[model samples]
Target: MTSPATSDSAFTNNSCDTEKIHILDLFAGPGGLDVAAHFLGLESTGIEWDANACETRYSAGLQTIHADVRTMRTERFDELPDNINVLAGGPPCQTFSVAGNGAGRRALTEVKSFIKRLVAREESSETIDEELSALGDPRTALVLEPLRWVMAAIENGKPYKAIILEQVPAVLPVWNVYREVLESGDLPGGVKYRTECRVLHTEEYGVPQTRRRAVLIARLAEHGHASMPDKTHKAFTRPKAETAPTGMATLDEAILKEAEHVERPRANRKEREPWVSMSEALRESSKKLGRSEPYVVVSNYGSGGDPKNRGRRTSDQPAFTVTGKISRNVVETPDGQPLPRFTIPESGILQTFPSNFPWRGRDQAQQVGNAVPPRFGAHLLAAALGLEEGRVAEAIEKMDGWPQISEEERERLRKIGCGDKGKCPTKPPHPQG
Candidate 1:
């Protein structure tokens, strides 16, 4: 399929300045940031590496360049709209995820050293490449790709007005280093920006999962102060006491009183609605299919290759963070009798993908797993654009619904599996996206 037309502006400029605000999303897996930009009535283009994710982006009518961000820089930048004001990306985080093999943690010190060397202009071209090659795992340095692009754009006199990046919380310190470099105007070309780095819990922003992301937002050339987004939903707090089983139930009487007497903690009281749970989001969908009460779901609790890390999620709580293996999540009855695994549509719902959004191509679960929840993304974009509170709330609500899917698409995704040896109940050679 052909790419979306580049001639058309992604968004119009309503401000006194004539330049429009288009977003260029680097490392744009499945176009999550683009989806959020669209919700705000903005235009965006994404550069993604994986073919399956690119295919999903294409099928959904999103503008995308199906190539690696590292290699696509020159050609893709040349095609960017004149007013590409915002740059956003969520670089692949497996190398930096806390739940993974300690590669990210172990490499953190070296990654920070690299960032310092990069900023200090201490390494020659040969040494830079040699050192990156010598790292224990080079993927840890993928987080620096955005910084490279930012410097390049600035040097070209086309610095993005706003920059946004998100990753697993383990990447926070790296973002902090980026914040220092961007704010200090330390680059050879001397571009200065204001940046804020923070850890954001997705549930606080109304995503129906407890995912935490390390986020950095920047305004180029100190155009304005950069602020992290405010939460739109109530934060889920556990009792001070260690309640058995769920670890969130009852606390000592004094502790409960202390909790009530203390400040509400969250900023916005008017909009502090309760957290939406997996049961609440999926209940109606399940009932529509005549599934009975007492739904049960079993899936991995953490991201790792080990089976021991897998666990279950009751209907009452929001699901553990959805991962690339999400399709393997089993839906069962009360007695542990397995029903169907979560259909692709249901998994999308959990991840806040619009209902019926085309999830075609290979590695559907990975594509879905890696995506930023559109609602959460919309909230962050709204904050970036300084959209009014009313408008932010409105956009989020609109994104919360399921996209309508046709039976043909549903049938196509039925029995979706990884298709690895012995992994599929069906036959070998599972359909590739």
Candidate 2:
């Protein structure tokens, strides 16, 4: 078990009043956390800036305030239902992602300094605005927006009962600062919080992707304490691993002989199932596309520019973290014959979105790539609320796959379509809503 951010007692909140709680999700991209809250039967009001994301959220029947979170004040939240007691969000991570340029990397020092100032009650709105302008990338400072909201809520005496946050592993240190401040009573008031921060591999929670995120959960209630959820599955086996990392099962040479690709060894006793492979998730897409044998997706860019970093994942394994430029992943037959890139529907499935979940507006890929897998979010929210994971089953509404495309649509796509480096279109022309 991960250590608590404070020396407070580990209070297993057995309060059956979880249903009375609602959530206010910040930087609420397409309602990822809201979806999870819904699965736990919790109502939510989300604030987001992206027009496209708001459209998608509204279409999904989620409540949303289509505006920048920075403009949100305590007064705006006052209009929400009185049941709002949980605050959750995953900030835009482009600046913090290791896959990006060094903008977020360079801004880390200043961001940390800003955190310290906030904890010291020295950061004013004018100072914040000036420093945010200096950072060049405004999103880098967005990670601190949740802290602002929490502070505002506390001052208003409407402190949240629970708080949940997620970001790339690069943001772990920032969250650590948050952990210390919340638990050490470093805020403006004497209200110390119980908190825990850890890096969680999504595959271990049964997400069909190998994404890892820094998660922090805190609660202000007297009996409130939060910790990482127990792993339900094992980590995906790497192409090469001399030793297994924590929470990952060790695979001996003998176990590697059972199949062409090694199944991630089971770690927990609760569920011994293998990690869900990309093949398992897109079996129908493979059949429809007339490709059943194993294949490779070679991305145009990877962690860096190294050809060795050409982000490649075989069908038998969970996919690498999908990115905003996900369409750049080029598919090729096992024998090295080039094929098309992944279709939008296939990409949505990789992100664990419903098959027919409508992706609205331009930059659709970014919306899908940035979303938290609803499945993973459900597990985290359920665990935080001390509720049975079974509650999510009834809440998940299934949908159909991509609608069929007409020849007219096909022609239009071909005329305007291109791939990374001007390659041919991946999936056939379909409606881009």
Candidate 3:
């Protein structure tokens, strides 16, 4: 279990009773967190870059800004409504991701440049080093991005009362940096926070996906006694004589299959054509897209438990960590062709993203491969929003209007991402909201 952030117990919150929360989603790829906000009837705005993602956001009627967050001024955002309650998201984790850590290491230089978007130039690197010195050391510098923004908030005396972040376990090494740079720093007032993180399984959070993410929440409220969000779902798997059934969600149970009556364009069939064996799509996509060589799941395994468990293990019980490099190989095909690589929609389902959610970018594989599922993002948002227990369920209402695809609409989408061949499995075209 991950330790709780410094001390949510520090103080009881009094402001939430008096106001509604507005969210500013940062590095907000496809707005998974916002989807939860929508369900709750809350309003949110997101910043994402990628033509496809932009198109998706607009089509969904979300107030989205298509821009590089690292290029925008974090401080300038204060101009947004004062009711803004939370800042939440799983930032682009590529620079901190375990897969292609070599790629991450090389990309760190670009990631580091994002700091300028937060800290003022007058703030010396010495100041940053000094503050970080007080917090714990992080495995990768990517941990500092959130801290930079949080520290800036405190420096400006306009801190968002709460902050939330999500990533994979590979990001834990940088905890010390968070403690020192953000928590340990002296803020405008006595305002300071403690950091805590846990490795959380998305399946445990009620999402069918077996995604495990590192979750952290920081609060301005003093830590007298903090409270962790209660888990709503228990772990389940196939029942065994020796072990009780671990009723884990099958890939089928987890995905939202076709919406009934999707005829004439009302069907919500979001689930991929039920896990077609790698008969033709794979071979044809291979030939058409020249994807002849099988792709790899690039990452490392944990030390404890079976080391073999660290790498890929095909099972109905658990899934390999999601990565940008999904392949037909993770689960394996009957013909030994590897598990059929997910269509972007299937990838989103695995990530707990809702159907009809749009993804942006020329690289469908890379974007879905890198995104945090919205369903999981919703949990983190619930924690950040300090939502009342039963109330969190209300957020699903926000998706009630998540737009629909008509037969005409689906055809239009297939034309853009797939063309005439029907081999491309990218996200649907953005149906303008």
Candidate 4:
């Protein structure tokens, strides 16, 4: 029998996790994080606010809860698994993204504190204290929500021993706030003031897309340790290229060499529409093309009534941040002319979703808007884990030689030959008959 999308993927069966870890993915969409975590052998419970996202996760055998993290605490839960060692989530980052006018940065004050308190409560639980939780709290890094939550969780003792938060580069100021907060010792947890923050571009880290995010990593064991997962992939170069070399990765290189781009059969597919090419975007905006183009423009004036026309889009530039809101996906028509809405898959690919992956939301916009780029998130998490980021097949090529022993077999041998083996040595006595 053929396996479902949930059932079989060679890459998933052998992700970098290589061990077991527990994860709580808050605001996790379609369980992309869950899928990656599961690949790393981490058990996950995905909590997503969107019903469509919940269904997508459900197809993967995840215990996907459809509820907003912002409202989850107010609502009571019947039962839940024990203390989570790892807590993870990407908060809905609408009001605080860099793409918008530098407004809504205030989302931190409005909602971040509640999330902090939630983390505090979860950490205090006897159930949770027993295990490690890798949680990405606050979703957005606005006002250092993740750091603040970590501070709360530790509460003078160590709660989250390891924490990693991802955000847009524009949020560096907030990270500075994290430094200030932890240093001030104004919150809970034993976290010290000094932490580590770095810029991690997904493209540089083996993800096929051109996404750069600010990553914060902290090692609580030290007097003060805040660190992030380091980069693994490098830029694609000329001459003879090396695989897994600490170099740059190119869009064409990663996509063609690594990502399995979908090629829908022309006969069965809808007639494809050709849009302005990259070169077209590089040209100057047309003076004649005002907001009058309805199908092509996303302006409020003239015919540009569509909400997608709020901003200028060009092929040469990376797209604006892809938010949970689909209304942001519109673009002005080429030639400054009016045009139809961006195709769901088109907008989705712009956000870095693999072409072959399918989305499940009711509308094309909903599906494209709700999803996190699996390839990007996968690469980021892999980098965070301090392991290589590549598909199983790609990874295989990098290894000097394949191990003769299977992982399961090696694990069994390890149990018998390593852990507690010395305490109680066992052997078959010499049988001399």
Candidate 5:
């Protein structure tokens, strides 16, 4: 595998010095972070192995390298250009997700131990790979791929200036362990990173879903001030019931009726904006599809440990966590009239992708479901790079309506930088809102 030729051109669109910050995204599913990078006028290349997702990336004119991250370890690290000073990725989370088999959660202890050994150089790469192979599912070991690349880059004398990683909430402990090793300067070149890891609520970041992700951000110790981004929106809270009035059919009925009357928590405008709701997000799509009435989403799966008790959320609330099975959820009007489930583009909207983002190939639902919402990614990138809040807001505003570039324009932009430039916008005009 050969690295794409480096370019010194500056992206004149945003405030960041684009010539100095290039990102390499690993396990980059469907170009979520890459979209965020592009909105910020930063150059990025995604390494994804899924053909379906690669097809979507190709259609969207994003830069991509169709390869497994594991193969990029060690000597292959040299194949990456030296201009890549930033590393960002959300590795496969199937094993760690609640919807998954939990193989990664079960192997957390072993994975943590491997992290220590790798940082200390206590074992050969082959030995570690052999042990990792025994961990039931092969994807379980992919979570550690980011750290391996970091170590490899340090040894190659090109340590990334900033590193951003994210996965399911269950991976927080793993990130905690990473925080330790990274800050300890125990790796090959004794590079010390100022790191922070925590579980972030997507709703607080303005995504129209209530997903939680474990995020880790690190910067070279000398870079100064590395921390999680501040919440830009208020968190979503379930509505509570108020006391029933004098005339009521029954306690249950009264509770149900009065719940809507109860005041939900609200954020002071000076503090943060209110959390985005499903209705607001789908409003445009609903209008285009001629759906104006309120609806409820009846989940396909069980809730509260009872298979019969399916979870339900009204259109007014933020959506429940979106999974690959999103298409399986049922949508119905308040009066029990059946409605169409969210379309692929609607699901992408809920995940904070632009409504017009070109989704191609098979398992498009999975690609949308698994993506890191571009709005959320922009916040994380801004915080990690110490950009101003205004810059983050600007990037997110553009995401509200990402334009669909023409095929001819896409071909021209795709040739701007390296042969595999994911989202290198030379002068991405302000997209129409």
Candidate 6:
């Protein structure tokens, strides 16, 4: 496929303009950040090679270039429009994820070395490419792709005004290296960015899942602060069973003391809301499915890989991290009566995608698992663009449904056999205990 830069029609078709913030999302899987950008009233074009994700993007009417990021040369930026001022992406995180083999984690040292080399211009691109290939898994090298694009943009004399990147928490060290390089003032242009990198809890940002991501935000030094957004919800604490008071303490007295301690923080509680619970987040799903009883989710995998020690959570708590194996999880009433596992829409909802967010193509579970939650992305986008808090709230409200696609666009996607009708199985293929 041709690079989006050469295909000026991509920008023109999307109505990209200089008046508003426009984002170019790299490795933009299935329009997660694009959904947030759309709701926030920003234009974005995502570059992705995965056919599965491209199908979904087309169905959702998201601006997309179905090409690999690695193939898009740095020189392509010379042809890109001036309106695409922001850069945002969440690179593939499999090798770096805690649940996956630790290839990326093991290669962290080598990756950092590569960053230093790139910043100092100590090695040619060909040499660095050979070194990166030597790393065990090819995906491990992708963590540094964003840095390459950033340097390329600067060299092209069109540095982005703001940049946002996120991945599994294990990638924080990589982002720290990015922060160092961006702020080092050694780029082709003397462009400097005020940067911050930190691990953010999704539940702290109102996502109904307890996912943690390492995020980096950088803004041109001429721009104001580039801080992470303030948390808008209280952090989730796992529920613990109550035990009878020991020794001289009576049960009532102990209960009273515990209540007082909890109440003490109430005076300042107005600053943030309670962490969103699974029941509250999935309320609409439950009602639509005609399930009135409370339920518990029994994880498919064990807590830390022990088959006998499966994890369990009630509807009152935020969901455990949603993963590709989400269909393997068992949902049941509190009394142990089996209920259906979450459908595709429900799974997307847990990840903060709209319930009707048109999910299509293969490995739909993986798509949901890999996406940067739209709610979380909105906050990141707002902070990077220096937008006010109200913008985030407004954007979130718009996420209740997917964006409406025009009839002409729908026909265009339909001709390519991509439409709003999602083909992925909603229910699991077979029953599981």
TM-score of each: 0.79, 0.79, 0.61, 0.51, 0.84, 0.83
lDDT of 2 at 307: 46
Task: For candidate 1, write residues 124-175 as lDDT tens digits.
Answer: 6346545654565556557777887887787777777678888887777778
> Candidate 1, which segments miss by more than 4 Å at Cα?
1-19, 74-76, 122-126, 237-271, 302-310, 400-433
The prediction achieving the highest lDDT against the true structure is: 5
Residue 66 miss distance in model 5 (angstroms): 1.0
Best by TM-score: 5
After best superposition, candidate 4 residue 198: deviation in angstroms?
3.5
* Runs with alpha carbons beyond 4 Å of true place in candidate 4: 1-18, 74-78, 98-102, 106-158, 180-194, 206-210, 222-226, 229-358, 363-367, 388-433
Over 1-433, each residue of candidate 3 has an lDDT whose tens digit, in order, gives: 2233333232245224313567777766656777776765567777665656655655555666555443333424544455555666665554444343333333343334434423335666445544433333222333555665665555565676667777754443333234333464454455655455555666655554446566676655442222234455655442222121123123112211211112233234232222211222233334554444434331234322233433433333334445566543254433455544556654555555554466544666666666666656666666655566556655543432366545566445434422453332133212101
Give all candidates' CA lDDT scores.
0.66, 0.67, 0.49, 0.42, 0.77, 0.76
TM-score of 4: 0.51
Error of 5 at 30 (Å): 0.8
Q: What is the lDDT of candidate 4?
A: 0.42
Better of 1 and 4 by lDDT: 1
Q: Which structure is stronger by lDDT: 5 or 6?
A: 5
How big is the positional error of residue 5 in model 1, measured in Å on the Cα after superposition? 30
Let me know the TM-score candidate 6 reaches against the reference structure.
Answer: 0.83
Pull out the clashing pairs in model 1. Answer: 355-402, 355-403, 361-433, 362-433
Q: Which of candidates 2 and 3 reaches a greater TM-score?
A: 2
Identify the superior model by lDDT, candidate 3 or candidate 5: 5
Question: Residue 81 lDDT in model 4?
Answer: 45
* Prediction-by-prediction clash tally: 4, 0, 44, 45, 2, 0
Residues 1-433 of candidate 2: C-alpha lDDT, one tens digit per residue? 3332233222245333554667888878876677666656778888776767766665666677655566555335555556666788987777767555445656767887788787687657658756764686766777787888788788877777678899877677778788888888777677777877777778887677888788888876464556666676888776652222222122212122221222335354465468888888888777888765688877656333344456577888888777777898888888788877877768878877767666766677888788888777877776666665456544444322323445565334323212131332233111111
Ten-residue region with minimum lDDT total, candidate 5: 424-433
